[model samples]
Target: MRQNPERRTALLDAAIEVLAREGSRGLTLRAVDKEADVPIGTSSNYFASRDTLLTQAGARVYERLLPDEATVAQQMSSAVGTEGFVYLMREAMTRISGFRTGYLALLELRLEATRRPELREVLTKRVRADMDENVERHLASGLPGDAVSVRLLQLTLSWLILEQLTLPDIMTDEERDELVTEAVLRLSAPSKRE
Candidate 1:
């Protein structure tokens, strides 16, 4: 079947809106069709199955959660000292806060993948690719061969930010910054294993 980018975009946007407003349980073809103002049949035509539609929608949400390479690199580069790191951390936390539902959906998808090996493999591949690219960029900035450490740092920081964003009342900004700073220091410290 010939693809329609505009229609696809519309469907994806509608899916996000539905997922955000209604959560996973509320996702339905009729709801998405109404959200997109497209016919129910059109949604089914574009996405043959609920799994297909949810997976694609979840991917879109994941992409939206992470900043682009250039943006991340620039942030990392400009964030020289501890203060700068805090600024970058705060910015990242803020961005994640803006996409709370998307992040939640991503977490759900990741959990779902555990039961579905094929889905898990696909997500793992994408995550590894993203981590590899980020690791390369971080290494190119004159850091030591700390790809593993850097990847761990990225994952830890991302989860921290997601946690803070999802449950703002649980941690104050100052407390969060202190935690992040401590994590960065420990992760970047000289390692006996290395």
Candidate 2:
């Protein structure tokens, strides 16, 4: 069967929606086919296997989170010498929150990737790239080399955001903002070399 780009995109989009609405555990070929309005055999023809489809869907989610290089450069240029970094970070976090299912699905994929060497390598590379981009952005803001600290800060902030989503009313916007501020300050602190 010849690959149809439009149909493929539709299937992937449907996969994301299904995953988001139902979590990773709810994802199934038939569900995706129905969501995409495509025939069941169509998904199998394109994806070949459940793992392949899920992995591709996960990769698509990651790609969606990252700002294009042009957009990042533009934002960085305009953000110089201002609190724009905080704004940008908040916006990024907000986007992540919007794709909560994608985040949860990623968590599931991470575990699955552990035993699948090929998937593991792919996930590792993608994660490393994200971390490197984040570290580079932080460093460019004049923060010292503290990659580990920055990673910890990111993890903490992500946890808080995810928790807020899972337990709405557990945290107010003011509380989340305060936590973000504290984490950013800690991560942006100058290193001992300074």
Candidate 3:
């Protein structure tokens, strides 16, 4: 197998694009090679099998979608109460939605994971780790949510994002923004004293 890290990354990036545009069923080594504009056998040299490519692509999507440290720090600094939680969730929704292709490819990876155990393992681990981190961050940042609230936001916002990505025409941007705000406020509001 080739050991050029740069080339491998390039192929994975291409695979992501192919996955987003073509869905999981259309993902092929030859398709990746074409998308990368490398020789016909280039992707094969970098990846041993279709499963390898699928798993790697799943990892790559998160790698590409992760917010940079500076952004995280900036966002974390401003987080305060319910409003702060609202801002944080809105920012998160914006950031995640901004990378349309990465998220779309991730959707493809999720569909493919059902048929491929290795891919399923990789995605489950990555997603779980991400959720754990988000829960910890929400707790530490003094956001208005408990771990349960954070988890709920994760589920609700994810579906909203899915709707935004797949059938954006269904709702206006302002309506989506309202939904995010409502979810955060309702889910994270302080409980009444007993």
Candidate 4:
């Protein structure tokens, strides 16, 4: 067995696809190995247990979808004021949609976490950290509101992402963008055109 982050990421990505398509029951270590098209025992070299694999896979899914440093920096430089905030929100939604399969696997992980207390706590802590980071970014970008506003913003975007991805045709892109823009404006509170 060799140590390779790329190999590890590939295995986790394979696991994500399995979880997304076949549900958790089918996500065996063998399935992950097969999914990655590697040797039969390759997954064992990376993950000690099925739960370990799944937990790491869940973390990987979120980790992969985080905003790229360059993009975040670019947004910070160019995106200011009400419209810029809307653009950043839109960018976030686009990222969510771009990683739809990974996000679906993430939802499966969330459900699985509920029955496993330790996993649940870990998931909660990680999710809260992500949220807190978003709030910090919002403030750094000079957007209005605090944690409450960020929560509302997250709720709004999550609902929009869920409905848009699952239902499809529930709302046109223009309509959805308008809804997101308005929600950001309301939650951000400064309203003045900057």
Task: Give the candidate number with the greatest lDDT.
Answer: 3
Query: Could you tell me every candidate's TM-score relative to the true structure?
Result: 0.81, 0.84, 0.96, 0.90
Lowest lDDT block of 10, candidate 3? 185-194
Q: Which order, best to worst by TM-score? A: 3, 4, 2, 1
Arrange candidates by lDDT, descending.
Answer: 3, 4, 2, 1
Cα deviation of 70, candidate 1, in Å: 3.8
lDDT of 4 by residue, 1-194 (tens): 45899999999999999988887888899999999999999999998889988888888888878878897888878987888878888999988988888877887888889887766777888889988888888777776566677888997898798887778799999998999989987887853553
For model 4, give the 10-residue run with minimal summed lDDT: 185-194
As a TM-score, model 2 comes out at 0.84
Q: Per-residue lDDT for 1-194 in model 1, tens only?
A: 22998897788778878876777667777788899998667888788777777777767876787898798878878766546645665686678777876777676667767776765777788788878986887676654336776777778877786677567788887888788777767776678875
- Assess the local accuracy of residue 175 in candidate 1 as a C-alpha lDDT between 0 and 100: 85
lDDT of each residue in 12-112, candidate 3, tens digit only: 99999999999998999999999999999999999999999999999999988888889888899888888888888888889889999899999999999
Candidate 4: regions farther than 4 A off = 190-194
Worst 10 residues of 1 by lDDT: 80-89
Task: Select the stronger candidate by lDDT from 1 and 4.
Answer: 4
The CA lDDT of each predicted structure is: 0.73, 0.74, 0.92, 0.85
